[model samples]
Target: MTTTPALETVGITKSYGSHSVLRGVDLAVPAGSVVALLGSNGAGKTTLVRILSTLLRADGGTASVNGHDVATQPGAVRESISLTGQFAAVDEVLTGRENLVLVAQLRHLEDPGGTADGLLARFGLSDAGSRRVATYSGGMRRRLDIAMSLIGDPPVLFLDEPTTGLDPQSRIEVWRTVRELAGRGTTVLLTTQYLDEAEQLADRIAILHEGRILTDGTLAELKQLLPPSRVEYVEKQPTLEDVFLALVGHDTTAT
Candidate 1:
């Protein structure tokens, strides 16, 4: 028999005062796969993550994480999922190791120290484990936050723009880590404005616009939503640079 989806949201809607953020949004994430939520700013990506992580309630509709209703079974949902927000949630005053230990302890895990050590080593933060998080670089702090999120070994992870402000190398490192997590049977729901990131990591891609899913499918499928790719042959063909400038009015080669 097929296993149940790791996450599901049906007709989820949320409003703040007079403004509606999510308008009957629906999503499903299978275990051991990456589901990328792509959208422009204000498309409700963060709001959806908050609802799924049980940090906020949906104004209407229902959501479930690993078969537990988010509204009625929030504790069970929390037990099965972890969330890493756009900002690194590390405590700047605490050491990297201290942060992991604190998370493990809060999860009520036995041998929090051993767990912290293992995570530090896994995330390549072992050498800096004793240093205060304030001294770490952006990438290191992001890694530490992700490691802390894994203290409970959750079955599902919610990454909300986890690499928002990193350099290219650091972003690649985080991507590798995300792929590794999904490979280990952890379902991942990733939200990002980066189209390339979504294409690289998502098994399925969903684009949100105006608080609704405009389209959802595989990379090839999403590309199909755009005009068909054109092939041209020339002695000295226009490069992607020239094409980008012609279409989008940005000169990629200009300093």
Candidate 2:
């Protein structure tokens, strides 16, 4: 039996006046799987994400999350998903625990304090819970950010460049958390410039370029589409953008 996608889009289109940001994009993300969306700086990845998350409306075409139409049933879509953007949305003045509490209150979860404490411990921030977010390290703040997102236990999650500026170790921590989330059946749609992050965490990957998907498949399948690397090294090295160029071509790689 085929499962209905946790997230989906068809002929999705968007534009800013004369500039078209999206053009007839089609996508389907399976339930309980992690899918990574790869793209360059202005490839409209965020635009597509925002549309699915209800932060932005598509100019045309249809999109849905958890089977609810993004345009017409936006409230139902929002109720089933959570978004974690490039920057942490936490407040610096609030303690780590307080930050989670704020989100819990906003979400109307019962026992906001207890929910905060549970999330703190789950994210390994239990000891730092009382410390002001102003003093937390970047990784700590990110962990808290994700933990706060999880308080609602929404079935679908959108992580937009979540590891962008994190140190290597912290990036790994976030990657691990993402894996755990998927393992527990959360459907994750992650967009990132870090190719390795996608390779490491995503069960499938889609390349978004020129306002469209050039090709999408498992890592091994995508590699097969590209010609064998002519330049070999003592240590195999394929930069994320190298993979990007190989699969999607150079049209979208403009600096």
Instruction: Tell me the TM-score of each prediction against the true structure.
Output: 0.88, 0.89
lDDT of 1 at 222: 77
Taking all chains together, the TM-score of candidate 1 against the true structure is 0.88
At residue 133, what lDDT does model 2 achieve? 95
Q: Please identify model 2 stretches exceeding 4 Å from their true place.
A: 228-255
After best superposition, candidate 2 residue 62: deviation in angstroms? 0.4
Checking candidate 1 for backbone clashes, the offending pairs are none
Question: What lDDT does each candidate get?
Answer: 0.87, 0.89
